[model samples]
Target chain A: MKKVGIVTGGTTKFTKTDISIESLLVSAIKQIFDNSSNLSQKDVDVVLTSTNANNKYLANITSELSGMAPKIAHSVESLCNSGTNCIVSAYAYISSGLADVALVAGAEKTDSPGLVLDWDKSRGQYKHPIYWSSMFTSAHKRKFGTTLEDLAYVGANNHRNALDTPYAYFEKPFSVEEIMESKPLTENLRLLDCSMPCNGSAAILLASENVIKNFCEQPIWMTGIGQKAISASFTKNDDLTSMKSTILSASDAYKMSKKAAEDIDAAELHDAFSICEIIELEDLGLVPKGEGGSYVRRLYDTKDRKINPRGGLIGTGHPLGATGIAQTIEICQQLQGKAGKRQIDGAKTGLIHNMSAAATSSTVLILES
Target chain B: MNKFEQELRNGNFVCGECSKCNKLVWPPSDLCNNCFNNVKWRPISKIAKLVEFSSKNDEYFCIAEFENQIRVMGKVENILNLHVGQTLTLVKCGFDGKEIFVFGLGD
Candidate 1:
């Protein structure tokens, strides 16, 4: 397979706004060009957009506004993991010689579907993801003796980490006591345990190895990528405590990259909820099974692990389609030692984990500098 | 209303049974999830075990498992200290005419 590398990335501030998705995409694209003097709109061979907005023809619209007529232009939608899936698609396109330079951008409004709990035909009135997360947390508590305090630590750590993240939505740190005392969205999940839904956009530029030599001085290589869709319905899942999609996808990525969980130096995981960070760590083999809570506590106490140096979705605000792209950008930044205050020392290899819809679908990517 | 919704309105909990592989399908689909064969609707066991439950603002929700590998999500009629593996019986099933399936549980 032809090798693909990330040339540069750009992100919009994560917050609630009335800006149109098109404008967000344009802005993100403009940021990419502004950051890299080597790249221009005319050099882009493909453009892909991912969003859950009601707008149509996003790819064509973005291309037109950005003043590029690329051979491939389309939109991708896979709920929250749409951004990662778009990158995966672009990677495939470049590896298959379909394009030399590809641009992938994701944007989502605060009111995107699946962000809010709504009355659904099949799942009844309790269709919010909190119900599913609550079940997972409760089951984890019963199986592993994970305490409410453990969950609180997860939220507190992410909030504290966000203090240094420039684009994070909530920069102020909340103590563990404050997180535990926050209003309960469910029996086990409190207001602080959940990630806020906001508006945002992020973009990444991918170039083939041949194209990178001409314009890029530093490139983060996309070594391995794995994506899996387990089950759309929560009831169809075999286990509630673990995300099988993450396990399967991460395994595929690790196998392709010829690396184990220990080889990764830093990571950007989809912490849509506090419990998700814990569960994903275990599922990705970063920590042993049923030790996610303990692992998080250790990270919090020692400040050693560079997990979610960008504060993840919980602190950065979850904008659905833009979230996974932002995760990729964070990992890229870390691998390049450009994450500023939150940068992990001596970071060489990194991983990104993003999932959607009750952990039914997942995308895992391994990057190396 | 569709057949599945009609059955639920009649106070019956039914799921699809695969004609080829004999696997049970929940949430009522036209094709079996395992074999992709035409599915036939059949009444499932009224008895189930609570797998997990949560309450918010005095509203209780539960995930219950039944025979033939069917798990249904529903509301608990009586609020109680529920535990995993607790036995529950299906009290009623119906649609609220707004396309939401309401599954009522009993002790």
Candidate 2:
């Protein structure tokens, strides 16, 4: 297999507002290329792009960009997983020798006002597995005795994590007590737990060994990659509390990397909701099931492990298409031991896991120094 | 809230029950998640619990937990910071001259 290395990466801020996703994406790409001496717009072998926007202008903007070679310029959409899956496809291209270097980028300007994007019709049809399994969350709340306050722990933890992150949209610190006393949405979920739409783009350079030699001397290696996508129907699965896709994807990545969950130093999981991060920790086997909550509690009480040190989507923002790539950028920083204020401290191996809405499609990646 | 056009109103807000695998899903899906086969749509009890949650108010926007079934969580609603064991149900009401179903304290 060809060796793949992430030469450099970047992320925009996490905030609440509307912005042109296409423009933000272009600017993000430009920033990455501008920062790198080895990478010009010319070195980008192919461009893997993801977004949730339906703007007509975005298509035009992409077509005019640099480095997207003719016939190689492709777009991949797994809705929210687009950002992360872009990294997966880019690695595949470089490792398979199809390309020497690739630019996997995700960007969304969901904060752009009056953008009436709708996918709820698909939810009724169960078109995606996440909505398939997760939408029931509404009715599930009705059947079970669980309260929305239980979900507050997740939001409170994420907000606290954001307090240390400069790029985080909400910089205030929150506690579980504060979160529980807040407000409610859909019973068990809170506004703080849900990710606000953001206006930003994240781009990463995936290069082969040869390409890395031309880029930077100290590039982070793309250590392992794995993905799985089944329909969103939770009825077909044996378990209801966790994600089959998340478990399977992480397992595949671990197997490919010859690493175990314990070997990872830090991580970033999709936190579309605060509970999402808590459950994903267990689903990815970072902690035992039912133990994830306790683990998060301890992490908050003591501040160890530093999961989602970048504030995740809940504290930062979730711009759909930009989320996966943004997480990758965060992972690269951790693996390089350069997260600055949010550094994982001696982190050598890092992991990233993401989903496409309500846990339908999921991707897991392993990166190392 | 004249949401007469809302799809959840026209349909039962389906869930899935796979006899083949004996698994259950809410807002039902087409295939059995376990058996990977076609499943039957089952009407849910609609009354769920609030197992997990968070709360926040960022000036103009707001969020809090309500309740749901096992593991995964539902959306945020216009309530207060609820305890871990609060009970609730999906309720239909009129808000600002609009008819809608919102999660509220259950009896």
All models, RMSD in angstroms: 2.0, 7.6
Q: Kindly report which residue stretches of model 2 are placed more than 4 angstroms away from their true locations once superposed.
A: A56-60, A66-71, A111-150, A233-238, B1-107
- Weakest ten-residue segment in model 2 chain A by summed lDDT: A114-123
Across residues A1-369, which tens digit of lDDT does each residue of candidate 2 receive? 899998887766655556666666777777677768866666667777777665653433564765354336767767778877878888888888988888766777754321221333322222322333233333334434334454566677677777776667787877777777665553344456577776777877788998697877778987878798865433333344677788889999999999999998989888887667766888888987666656776777687646888878777777788888888888888877777878888899999998865665689999989
lDDT of 2 at A197: 73
DockQ, candidate no. 2: 0.07
- What would the TM-score be for candidate 1 when compared with the true structure? 0.95
lDDT of 2 by residue, B1-107 (tens): 11223334653334557768767743335666577887765554556555433222321111112223322223435556655456656554222222123455656
- Expressed as tens digits, the lDDT of each residue in A1-369 for candidate 1 is 799999888998888868999999998999889888877788899999999887999999999999999999999998889999999999999999989999999999988975742433335555778888888888888888888889888888888888888888887998899999999888889999999999889999999998986556889999978899976767666787899999999999999999889999999999888989999999999999899999889888987547888888888899888999999998998998898988899999999999988787999999999
lDDT of 1 by residue, B1-107 (tens): 55677887777767788899988876578898777999988887888888777777888788888883667677887647777787888776766653233334444
lDDT of 2 at A188: 47
Q: Output the worst ten-in-a-row residue range by lDDT, candidate 1 chain A.
A: A116-125
